[model samples]
Target chain A: MKNKGLLLVVSAPSGCGKGTILGEILKDDSFYYSISATTRAPREGEQDGVNYHFITKEEFEQRIAQGGMLEYAQYCGNYYGTPKKEVEQMRDAGRDVILEIEVEGAMKVRALCPDAVFLFIAPPSVEELRRRLNKRGTEAAEVIEERVSQAARELSYADRYDYIIVNGELEKAIQDFRTVVRAEKLRTKNGNKIDEVLNHA
Target chain B: MKNKGLLLVVSAPSGCGKGTILGEILKDDSFYYSISATTRAPREGEQDGVNYHFITKEEFEQRIAQGGMLEYAQYCGNYYGTPKKEVEQMRDAGRDVILEIEVEGAMKVRALCPDAVFLFIAPPSVEELRRRLNKRGTEAAEVIEERVSQAARELSYADRYDYIIVNGELEKAIQDFRTVVRAEKLRTKNGNKIDEVLNHA
Candidate 1:
């Protein structure tokens, strides 16, 4: 039987370095990034299946009806959910799977997959988070204010996470993430090396 | 009511740099290193209460009889145990308590303190561990062999640890240890700063 890969759940405030770190983590061969399925219209230059599995609302509803989605939620009048097939296939192939979801979705996924490692990525401070959001220069003042407020709310649940990674330094944060992944691999349930030693010795 | 500090259980093989990492960790103002009471004669240059609480067999037995020690173990013809009073007082003062104990004593501490964070420090490879053991230049070849064998055996229980820190690089291992500490401090049961916000807000 093939060994199953670890399920990693990552949550962060909007402006935190989750995307950047997740992108770096994707470079590792042993990890498979779980592509989300959504009913929202695909943004410019975004691929239909690569960036997201962009489907019509009816198609999304059908998947929800058939229990194909692992966790689904309606956000901004659009449906978003994690597809079960790809994640299961990757895990069965002995490749770790990563889920980048909001805090609320991460909590739901935790209930569904209690074995997954829940990581909360936070900026060094709330002021730093605001600075990053302001530097983005994509939203208006009102929108930025709303985002800052939501960020405060998201951070309030940081204690519920199994691990908290501070995004103060990119290289340090990346190293810590790598350490967590390596340590997780050595886990009894996940590491075959441990089993091999036990069975032989 | 005062907040209880997290009880940190640190365990490692004989030559895994556990002592060095722990020494640095103890220097942090937020951490209080537990002074173990021993029933052995103090070595030259070793302070009575600073390096260890050197007590007579009678005093040790009396403390044991009075239910004062957290966990006691007989090793190499000497009894060593963590003093309960100092650890409790440090915890009451909101300083995290660090226990540097062997695997057996670590397991005992875990049973007594279920919320404690158990971390296992490990060398990169068995060969490296041997090199470190030999480099000490204080133990005989046969004794070093015995220690390596014991380390191999201890490593078999790595699965029991909450986190494994590989001492490949000193700074990296220190950072990883600190990351785990920061994360544990953010846990809901210990301080629950995050929970307090979400509920109150």
Candidate 2:
């Protein structure tokens, strides 16, 4: 029998290099990146159902009212949420799904799917985070300061995560990420088939 | 600060190829093979402190009374037990320690060190185990049957272990074992130093 796929929930503060780490992890096709359903219009060159499953605000609210959304939030005056059916379908088909969300959304996912593995990617330090934000040069000084403060709050939630990886060295962090996935597969909960295999052997 | 090494408890049924697997794992000097203490007299070429910490019955009982042993059992008119201090010393020095014992002893160690990782190595099947035991030619036919029955009992406890590796393909089992060890080291409990390093950075 095919094993059920693991639901991996990854969360990190902005500028913590989580995107780069997750990008490396997704290079292997074994993972299914969960696409969020958003009520906002697609950006330039963003394709529907690829960048996101774009929906009307009314439709999004209807789905929420029908309890179709796994987790949803109002972001920049638009609804952004995980479509429960797609994730369930992918997982039931034995495709490991990756859900990259913020702490609030991640906690919501945890409550919804307690079996999911919650991983937190952290920057090397608050100082390093400040440096990365400043180096981006895309935000105003006050905005960068605000992001840094927000990051400190996020870091406080690290202990609540099942695993934490400090994205200090890219290769090392990637290896750690892979190791967690590999080892988690070997857990007794996932390897129950071994008993049947042995029984038949 | 040096991270405390992991106390790995390995258990397997007889003729499950645990010794060979453990030999491969010990090829790396990062692990300290825990030497068991016993009141049984040493055979030829069995060196004290190397083969076993041969102790007198009085001494063994004394240590047991003083709570120096992690786990102990009386078998064939002799006391066999794990010395708690040696395991602690090795772990304090950041050297992972392997305690290869039976399920009863493993349960004892678990009670003492709840943080220890407990792994159970299993054979592909009871039939395969019987074949291996018969091939050894070291035991009588009745003895082999007894061992096969005992293995069945041990197999039932596989779920109690944190991880179970079926020794079907030797290399694959070894890789699974190594992966578990590597991934466990990355756990937040063991990687708390990352926070300190980041704070200092």
- lDDT by residue (B1-201, candidate 2, tens digit) is 777899999999988889999999999999999999999999999999999999999999999899999999999999999999999999999999999999989988888888899899999888989999999999999999999999999888878788888899999999989999988886776655446536655
- In candidate 2, what are the lDDT values of residues A1-201, reduced to their tens digit? 777889999999999899999898999888999999999999999999899999999999999999999999998999999999999898888888999899999999988887898888988889989999999989999999999999989888887788888888889889989988998887777655447547555
lDDT of 1 by residue, A1-201 (tens): 556888888888998888899889889999998999999999999998799999999999998899888898998999999998888899889898999889889989888887788778877777777778999999898898899899989997788887777777998778767767665654445653433323221
Alpha carbon lDDT of each predicted model = 0.82, 0.89
How do the residues B59-96 of candidate 1 rate in per-residue lDDT, one tens digit apiece? Answer: 99999999899999988999999999999899989899
Q: Which is the leading candidate under DockQ?
A: 2
DockQ scores of the candidates: 0.18, 0.53
RMSD of each: 5.0, 2.4
Native-referenced Cα lDDT, model 1 = 0.82
TM-score of each candidate? 0.73, 0.91
